[model samples]
Target: MSTTALSKPWTITRLGWLFQPISDRGHEEAMVLSVYRDHGVIPKDSRTDNFNRTPENLSNYQLVQPGDLVVNRMKAWQGSLGISEHQGIVSPDYEVLRPTAPEYDRRFLHSLLRSRALIDQYALRSTGIRPSQWRLYWDEMKTIEISLPAAKQQRAIADYLDRETARIDTLIEEQQRLIEMLRERRQAVIDESFSTLGDPSVQLRRYIKFLTSGSRGWGDYYADQGERFLRIGNLPRANLEIRGDIQFVDLPADVTEGSRTMLQEGDLLFSITAYLGSVAVIKGDWVGAYVSQHVALCRLERDRVDPRFIGWFMLTTTGQDQLNEGAAGGTKMQLALDDIRGLRVPTASIEQQRRIAAHLDRQTAKIDALVAETERFIEYARERRVALITAAVTGQIDLREMA
Candidate 1:
């Protein structure tokens, strides 16, 4: 965790790992081998599908030995560091490093390379010729410097982190499992509400006094003026794509004239278009936008159904089925407003809607907490590994005399 500006002569250039031995033309046809960041146990691949190689588009190079720290030179900043415990052919973009001495643990080295500190430094050094084509060169990668403790201290640190992080990872996995269970429970709740055996509920159509059809097509609003014009693709699959990142088009002056379709808190935005059942609840008091041709601005009768509950249901299996079953297009499929308005919905009393929403809110909050913690552990486990490598190479953690 310390840095110094001193120069050292003990540094040796890395002869990146070799990989030609793992490739072969077998079974029926020639197959290309490749390695991905998900290859090892950190993400836990329980597949027998040869984590080594597959038919990939990229050329393969560099045989990575077990325990060799492999990094994608270009995407090193994006946490693409992994410890290769099995030999595999991967994209030539990978730069595999094996420490010259045992002072550094390979896992530690891999983690350090992926640490925020190293990643930020890598980002700072990178140059992007285009918006997407950014490159981080390997030659410059070697010069990254770090201060480290002695060899004994290095091993002690790695061992300490390995034990602590494993426990954290286990907890994270359990929390993640709990989140999935909550999701399943939420789906069950939806299924029960719609079933005839459940408490009395209202038919979906009764709530709407005026269910008008949506504005024509994308062509009708091309001339619209200064307001957020939302399209089907613009709507996110899960959470609202925090607005700053969402692309918006200006509404023509004529369309913005007193549109009741403006988004509001508790308003349920439904896509009755191609992605027929996708739904999202307005998170806060967002009031500027009007729906695109493909989206429906549902003014839900809040007395019968909670918009939040509807949003959740649409994302669940039952709601998806209800949507898919009502779908009515040939090639580029879509569900018209009439098709959706006539669709049956399971409803409950106001008190019940609030209760279901509150229960789901609590469960989702717990799931979010677990996801955040797991992410943090992933970062730490990754960083600790890299610190071990930085320490060993700089002569700060010396293992030259130990075998």
Candidate 2:
């Protein structure tokens, strides 16, 4: 085992002094950089080229250069600070700092400040009840203290973190790709199962007892606690699973207009707008839940069609293709209630439908288990990455000997 080096507490001002504010009063044409959390400075134009509507005046923006540290004061607590590698102009609200002493490594400072401990320190220094309103001013920021390692160790630590984090990130990317492939395989399975639909075709309305969308004006009934209010976000794309980002709304006596849209067990919910093909079968837990106007409720006749079978079929590519064909509007896609009612569905005997649904349910459960495992592994990798950076930059682990 190697012994760790001694560390000393250094004030922010001692490490690197704040930059002298330089306004773009000359109106020089320069790229605009947006400082983002986790991600460093990025050109605003690269994200969106439509800056034609931007204000013609650029005199209030601050000029930044390579190796300069930039911080979004309002979001500093959220780790929106980075060392810029571009010569550009940032919003006037951002603070720019330059290293006055050569002894301090900018990369080391960047890593250390972004660590969880320093982020917590920033939160403490910030003055606001809400995170969105929190701001870290220059006066308090300059006086903040951070542990400093030897100059040589600073570079070694930063280098070690840069290399290690990249390796972990690559692992995460591979895992994400595996998940995508698994999802594609799941889709393939559903498609194969539906390919043999040789039964008689009938319009969806012939089998569905009810087909209608929820009424509008439910936004005024939003509450912190009540019946679950399902929205487009709660419905996963091309799947029968419901997401956990559920909202609650109080169904007041006066708001009886949307009562018809209240979900029942085994009810099929379909997104009518934006995300057109998202479908989910409402379970017992969501029995009282009501969907937004953007979603449509389809109550199938139990004697004619199995809800799970229909749900599985809708998740297939063929089903999504039919939905796309029926979808209307250009930018904001939507499916009319009449179009949904007119959709052609291949019908089979109830017994065969049950068997198909059972097989698909088993297969999807296995795939979902694998996906959950991969996601958990990715989470662990991310946690390890953060821990490694924290340990290296804070001198908890000595990288000088390793280097």
| Most lDDT-accurate candidate | 2
TM-score for model 2?
A: 0.86
Best by TM-score: 2
Instruction: Give the C-alpha lDDT of model 1.
Output: 0.55
Candidate 1 residue lDDT tens string, 67-103 = 6666665666665566665655444566656655545
Q: lDDT of each prediction vs. the true structure?
A: 0.55, 0.80
TM-score of each: 0.63, 0.86
Task: Report the Cα RMSD per candidate.
Answer: 6.7, 3.4
Q: Compared with the true structure, what per-residue lDDT tens digits does model 2 show for residues 1-403?
A: 3436434442434322534333443444888787877577777676554353445787787788877778888998988988887888888788877655546677787788788888888889898889899998777777677667667767777787889899999999999999999999988888888788864278788888998898888889899999899998888875687886778998877777768998988888888887778889998678888889999899999888998898888778767877888885566678988888887777788999999999998998899899999999999998898887787777677454555
Candidate 2 Cα outliers beyond 4 Å, as residue runs: 1-3, 7-22, 25-28, 44-60, 198-201, 219-228, 245-258
lDDT of 2: 0.80
Q: After aligning candidate 2 to the native by TM-score, how far in Å is the CA of 125 from where it should be?
A: 1.9
